[model samples]
Target: MAKDFHPPYPWQTGLWQQLRHDRQQLGHALLLYGRAGIGKYAFARYLSQALLCKQPHSGHPCGECASCHWFNEESHPDFRLLSPEQAAESDDESAPSKKTKKKTQISVSQIRDLNEFLSLSSHRNDGARIVLIQPAEALNAASANALLKMLEEPAPDVIFILVANQLQRLLPTIISRCQKVSMPAPSESQALAWLSEQGVQNAQQQLAYASGSPIQVVNEQAQLTTLADIWQQLALGSKLQPHLAASMLIAHSAETGIIALQKWLCDLLTMRLTKQVHYHIGQSGALQGLSDKVNLSQLMQLQKKVDELRKLALHPLNHELQLEALLVEYTRVFVNK
Candidate 1:
């Protein structure tokens, strides 16, 4: 569903221009892929809305038109958004289930349901129909196969925009049917300038912490206090209590807490070997302290384990216990010399 349709970030200007330049020869499906948190989804939404708008200006939507109003209100007949959560919500709304478990994939049924929409003509004369599937890697095997059929015989007047952060996860057949657009990530200076414009303090720290993603910096700012507390507990190293630290860490989410530890461990591993600190330059002293005391072999193993856990973070597992076990292992990696 469409949220507040803020224009794409400033760094996306070049890519935006490129998309507009090729508007006439656009394919039935466009695959927009790039780094996470770099505003790929937002760009796709903007482009889709622009294409559906009755009065598009220079490849962007004319914000005042009735079509644009319908788009902003998430009621545009010609536009459909297919994401895991959105698909589940629609099912729940119609089926009236008792708080069904959240879905994680673009299900086969969701893709099959598109047939009904594809059979209908556009609501307006000469208006282009659009379907935007965000994080396209969320398509499971069956769903991907169903979608592959659509791509093979694309319905007229419909444009499918598949946005993905992890392109490697997509099927080769699926990727081949679409026109691929490689989204750009802003440089450090560009990202910092944008963060400055947003009046975000400590932009440099947030930028590095977010791996140069400005959107990530903005999102993480909301949880800075929690992150700082987690970092402090991590800085305790061998002294950190696994149960206590896990309690604080799980206050956010298992994924958040694991990512924090993974970052810290990454820096610890790197600093131990390369004398380089990446994500937590602000906590270089803490990282360096842990790096000196941590067992190199054990640290490497734990890093791998933590990385693996991140992939399974969305599973309905006991996250607090998992985190506690990880933290206990984290403490073991450090020992009194």
Candidate 2:
């Protein structure tokens, strides 16, 4: 049986019931919009499985069925998942000698290829077809336009489920065509409870760092140690070694390192201005000590640079060097002891 063949998250129970009960009222295109790392993609997947299940029980997928098996195996004939990574895979089959940059946009060609799939009838005569576009914001202008045409004249019994974290990035026409479903974010209590159920340690602290997203906390478990080390180095303020810190910071990826820096900077600002830390709840003492020494204007300037670096994290640039420069700047932002 498939691992993902389970029910929706506990917090999503109500919404799931409502959606399942009103399945007939759902539009051909469903826009599931919400904050990232809040299980929106998981919800979409569960819904898709349920829709394609041959033996759906009480509006849920029966894990024992052939359709469920196919879906779990990612070989369902009636289902297609359109994502930037998927588009990249289809476009680049040749093995690259060097480390190639990952693709970030769904190309127009990926959208155009769907025409043949849309024209074909479902594998099961009476079953429905599903096209799931995750992080729909990844659809570039050309691809978005191509998708719009399909949405305007959708195929018979075909459901287009678009999942998005940033809803504002999507075109207005696309938003208007679909039935928007506002996926709920779990409350702090709900999130903590879920984390506890999963046997995650330091749930409250992790939850705060993840911006209350339970899913993100779970996903970032392995990086917790690295993040803690980064925080300790950051707390060193003016005495921090830029070169050594830069190597450790970008150990995972340039983006991850940048985000960690951004969050640390955010907490520093919060601590400096309001005497309260948001993300780094457990680092209050360290933040307070550093915040007092931090030059506000200099910190803000470094924050802007970090933001810019994060935006260009995917580009083929010397991230380690850039990060090292930023850490050096970070050191300069604090007064000498």
Candidate 3:
């Protein structure tokens, strides 16, 4: 019995049918590539269910079989999933505990674990093994090399599915070994429609901030949305209290504050240079006044600083100090009145 799995909306039903046919012929390795939050993970899960289905149906899982139930319960012996830890501490929290925990990255140790797990015989006495590596590019050099070795001499009856948001970040050897499944971002109209259906009122505005990723439109994180609103307010050159607004924005969504700040500032700087003063304060506004007030050279310099800040945010070291510096720089730019 296959698990009762229904595909997510952004996925193509035709592709699902084609995959079912390919599986019959034993496709050993599949690379599912696409923009993040566009249903790649859901599709990967669907394929896992289909492969483990005890009672298959209509090129999908039957959802009622013993194997399917175990899969849904996440107790399937032959199924493996690998993902990065979501919570990495701020520098303030990290310094005192520095020796206790290492910074998070998919390292060789994890690959070794995978190798050991896959070495054993299947519990179902079937030759199938399903392993998913998400954000596959997270694999550091040694880890990726270890994976390459596995790919070179893949186990009999084993299937590896690599899901990557940024395919270009993956190593060439890794890219060369697997069959690629390219997934495009949904069409603009399609994304907009889905966002509206999800009850996003300012869908177009947020869609612009998302740069076409519909998942951002439906992002449940209030801070991500509020971050956009802050940017909208700033770009509009609003008279609101800067510290109060910034504090509220960061308070609600500390998770993505740096990223949101950097990206929004970049876009604002771009507008300043292009002199396309139409701003999105949850609505587009005339830029005539903002265009005159902001200096093009200052905006260019600020853009470079933001780019450097982005690189700094990637490192786990000095996170608090770095965030503080970022806030200071932003204050200098927007609140130096």
Candidate 4:
């Protein structure tokens, strides 16, 4: 319905094209699984538009049509979307806080709200009623079970598109009810080329740091500009300096920030393995020194450690304690260096 519907990325176009065709014949429900920020949300939206479009071109929706305009304005009564609340109100905003509030998970209430919204007949009376639920795993057991019931007996001409970052977290019954579509990460070279084309001066460096995610690299470049100083200390294996740096980094950005730092470590290790001297996104003189200090085995171990920590981040853990433990463990791994 939106006139400004951005097309899927070049890599994602084929998948969307396929989904468009499926919608033409009227698919009931779909589960779209992909890593975050890979345009899963956008793709779901594109599909929703195609289904509701009164004047579609082949399988694609005509953006210029009236239905498309309503969709774009987010006024289409048939269209619904649900996502986790971004930030909760802090108790003490006036005082300096050490930690921010976590993004709350989607609960049974949201799903219940959706059930009520969809139970009624379509507002438009004829087009498909579309619902897009992102990071659907944020649902608690009660919420998930509620969704399961709806999927089992979906209304006629209704579509449910569930997007998830971690498919494994979903119940098997939930996954089995809908068609599964995998959104693979782009190839390393393809991601790097996209970054470079976007005028990233150090495309090689950034791509290596990002680990095949252009958005992650670009986002880190903008958000973690201070990481350079912290990384420099870590590269030199300055024990005291790294602890301080880690503290500062953790203090500034929580789980997501640490995830980016883990990406940096992975990139350095990747370069170490391949003996590639350049970074795709940005310059980092410390990479070479760090590579020399840590062997391939050590780097691989650290990479695994990072992954373990990232998985824990998805849960309702104590952020402060988790970060402190993570930093301490990170230091202990390369203490010999």
Candidate 5:
């Protein structure tokens, strides 16, 4: 086991116990589905490690044995993890470039490569072999069909754990073959406490921005400062300069900047209709003022445009110019009261 390997979060304790208690009755495949950033992947990894642990205590891996060492070093003969190539390289800042298109799907070749691993017997005496596929929605048509064949005829002593953020994206046949587990999200208090322990500032505001997902709040800390700068420009409303704001908006990536704009527009709309804020709780005053000066019909039309632009954010288009045009329209959405 790795030093980072530990028991599940407080919210996941019951699910952990249920699965551990029924370990013998567990099926060959498990589909762990939930919203993004709720620790589903981490839970799957923990379960995989424990299942292959040579000396597990109370269904937890003892971080000392040879098997545990092998697992920690990512050299366990019986374990295999699958993910999109781009996702695997996401941590490297230089991974994304104009010369190379990012691969988003799990190709059929990846699934075919698993056949050899599935055919091999476990290196340990009767120990289980684990194959973990994270964000299982990444499996496209050909790969999903290839994976479905294996699920249809599962190998003995092999456990397949599929982690998905969007359950509907998976093939229905692939879903039907696995036992589905709905991972739990922490409560407001639980999330706040966890964020506090992790030394996060403004836990309440960040939590709201993350849609109550604590993991996202932590993962997105780096961007929060940039978000704040963007919000300041957006607060100018009708006075905002499109060309200047467009540069700041796409500072990270066009996708990230568009998402920020989308959230701000959503909050502004919500404030206009209900006098309530969703994503930008801290900026409710600004949203309320902007909403008062904005035309409802124009705002709605602009929102639709933004949504369409967001769908095409990954396309190799002139994103800065598109953002600038959107911002120009954004200023026009407001009228003198």
Candidate 6:
């Protein structure tokens, strides 16, 4: 995190205070978790810094301290960040799958490498050292077991803070070794107000489109506009040109386009079976028009195909052609009986 980065969101203030109040009582490892876009990772970072700071004051770290400078520069000798992307590179090896692509799992080799760091004492006298692992779910079966060993025999003066978007995805045994901190998801009003403060117009629309993740709204504003265009193409049903639509979607990513379609079709199915739609509340008219002409059996088959494609989205396939084929099938669902 940069020194100029914004503080935690308003909803996090209370939780921050709680952590401060129980600062001294904190365990060796902390599992901070909540839904995606709730700022759990940021909170973990803030806590890591505060704990490592040589001069903490008034419930926060003093940024002027040498310790703070080292942390901000990401060169603190005692501080380590264990994230999937970082782990893959830190092991002095390229990803076995794809050199450029990020691996989702934290390798066991990375966990074992921590033995050297854990063996050392803090760089500063009596000051805490922190190891922050984000999205703890990235620790697969082997990595989780390796981590479990460390948790069982925790090194003195070293703290492990694990941040996760999905706690259920983590190993239950690993979870039992740490203290769980459930981060709060801000209410819709709070999110919209925050977006408004950030000078984001059409806050409600953006927030809804992001499934209430304010961070995603801020990060993906441009993509949202592209999504709107894609939705318009999707509404064309039988008239939609597969190649053109596929190009636009593949430009973003195969996974992203598949997810967008999944969510849209989910709403379409809801609109078909019942008169209500959960996501894409703003695109009801277009979805309603498509849902009527869609054959239920074929729509179900298309959804299954999309799910399968999503599973293989990372494979080295001709993305544009695959999406075009899916879109060709998509148009068939609207054909007259």
Candidate 4 whole-model C-alpha lDDT, 0 to 1:
0.69
Per-residue lDDT of candidate 5, residues 1-337 (tens digit): 1232244976789999999999999999999998887888888988988998988999998879988899889899999888886443542455446334445778787789899999999998779999999779999999999999999999999999999998989999999999999999899999888878777888898899989987778777888757777888999999998998999988888888999999999999999999999999899989999999989999999999999999888677778999999999999999997
> What are the lDDT figures for the candidates, one per model?
0.87, 0.90, 0.67, 0.69, 0.88, 0.84
- Model 2 C-alpha lDDT versus the unseen true structure: 0.90
Candidate 4 ranges with C-alpha deviation above 4 Å = 1-5, 35-37, 61-66, 73-75, 86-100, 218-221, 224-226, 239-252, 260-337
Q: Clashing residue pairs in candidate 3, if any?
A: 1-54, 1-55, 2-62, 2-63, 3-63, 4-63, 277-287
lDDT of 1 by residue, 314-335 (tens): 7767878888888899999987
lDDT, residue 127, model 4: 71
Please report the candidate that would top lDDT against the real structure: 2
Using TM-score as the yardstick, the better of models 5 and 6 is 6
Single out the weakest 10-residue window by summed lDDT for candidate 1.
Answer: 1-10
Kindly indicate the candidate among 3 and 6 with the higher TM-score: 6
TM-score of each: 0.90, 0.94, 0.81, 0.72, 0.89, 0.92
The runs of at least 3 residues in candidate 6 whose Cα sits more than 4 Å from the true structure, single-residue gaps closed, are 1-5, 91-97
lDDT of 3 by residue, 11-129 (tens): 45667767767777656788999878677887888888888887888767888998889899988888888765422333325566553343456767667888777788777787488
lDDT of 6 by residue, 38-129 (tens): 77887788888888888889779898899899989989999998888786575446445565454677888878889999999889878877
Looking at model 2, residue 56 earns an lDDT score of 93
Error of 1 at 237 (Å): 1.4
Residue 134 Cα positional deviation in candidate 1, in Å, after optimal superposition: 1.4
